[model samples]
Target: MTTLRALTPADASGIRRIYSGAAVTYLMRPEMTASEAEAYVARVIEWSRAAPVAQYVLGVDVAGDLVGVVKLGRRPAGHGRVSYVLREDVWGRGYATAAVERLAAYAFTAAALESLGAKHHPDNPASGRVLTKAGFTCLGADGGFVHYWLDRDGRRESSGQHREGPGVSPGRTRCPRGRSSR
Candidate 1:
């Protein structure tokens, strides 16, 4: 089962492990040191306490273990941007897709976001697939990244696989095989 929850100080070590992998870091950031990961966790925890909740840096848990992170940053005008990175060992297992799907539902409903944008490194088609499966339409590549967008109404209009309403239960659901290291 995959779940998204708030990050805690205890998640620093697992964050370090996920951020240290080459495939993950290549798409997300430069390799992170132990201290860097801890500091990152602290910053995210602080962000959670903000009045408007400008950002959500959620820990992606799979069967009780922290396997990755999914982030959604609020933008102007009820819009947001989504991104995610997973531990290399867990790639291609559909965890990223499942997490993204749940995140989208939350953004559209609980967060009251009207639209969300995403981008993936051109070389990482798997990330693109994850976004598409989550109902994001391609907006073409720009500045070395392939961009995508999902509007709350646009998602409802599409007759795709993700037609379910925003009330989707936060339970285990099978997803397509893909990685989302954005």
Candidate 2:
């Protein structure tokens, strides 16, 4: 099961665990050091607690175990970007896709976000597939990364299932506790 909830300072440790594990994976190449990853987690926790304008950082976990994070942030009066990372141990388990789906739904509900999008390093097809499953389509290549967008209707152009974006995808999974999907 996947959940999207508000993250608290207490979640910093779990978030750190998730991201630290992630940094070693291909999803986040040129990984950061442990201390740096810890600092990164601290910042995410701070941001989640602060709830800055046009941004929401969430943590993703499964069955009470912290595993990943999903982030949705906008550039102040601009489009929002959705991004996620999962531990290598959980790869190929569909956790990434489920977390993205829940976060997309929350983005549509919590904020009047016009669209939710993400980008994956060109070398990472798994990331691309996860975003595609969440209804995001390739907008074009930018700075070597493939961009994707999911409009307000939850309709993802890249999914190829709908020409128009649907407000939310067909499934609305349960939101777990202990962490939010970033």
Candidate 3:
């Protein structure tokens, strides 16, 4: 089963390993060394420990192994910008879609956000597909990436059956003890 957990400094190693090579480099920028990833994780942990924080980042795990990360970053419009990354070895298994979907619901609730946006390199249709499966739609290109958005009502208006209401965000209240609510 897939799970989402609050990110920890320990995950740096896994993330460092994933963010390599030409393919991932095309999506994730400024490829980091193992030591740099560790430093980044340390920064994340420190910032999260600070109360009233705006950004929320979570590690994606499967069967107790770290596989990816999802972030709901604050936007100037009182909403969020979603971003996620997965271990290259675990690609094409729907984990990215599942993680982003859970995070989208959580953003609409836990953060009391109205909308969440995401962007992917135009060439990386796989990333775009993950967002689309998670309920985001194209919003054209911006800053060298194709953007997507998912609003509160858009999520609720879907033809697919859903239980979460305006107050029903995933990965936070719906998720118990960092478990996958998907």
lDDT of 1 at 127: 86
Residues 80-117, model 3: lDDT tens digits: 88988887888899999999988887887777788877
Model 2 lDDT tens row, 56-139:
767676787777777888744445778787777788989899999888777777667777767766667778778777777655
Please list the C-alpha lDDT of all candidates, in the order they appear. 0.79, 0.65, 0.72
| Model 2: residue 34 alpha-carbon error in angstroms | 4.9
Off by over 4 Å in 2: 8-13, 20-34, 157-182
Instruction: Give the local distance difference test score of model 1.
Output: 0.79
Task: Output the number of the TM-score-best candidate.
Answer: 1
Using lDDT, give the best candidate's number: 1
Q: RMSD of candidate 2 to the true fold?
A: 9.2
lDDT of 1 by residue, 1-182 (tens): 99999999999999998887665644656878989999999999999999889999999999889999999999888888999999888999999999999999999998999888887776777888888888886655555566667888755233333322222222423222343221
Structural similarity to truth (TM-score) of each candidate: 0.83, 0.73, 0.79
TM-score rank order: 1, 3, 2
Please list the residue runs of candidate 1 whose C-alpha ends up more than 4 Å from where it truly belongs after superposition: 154-182
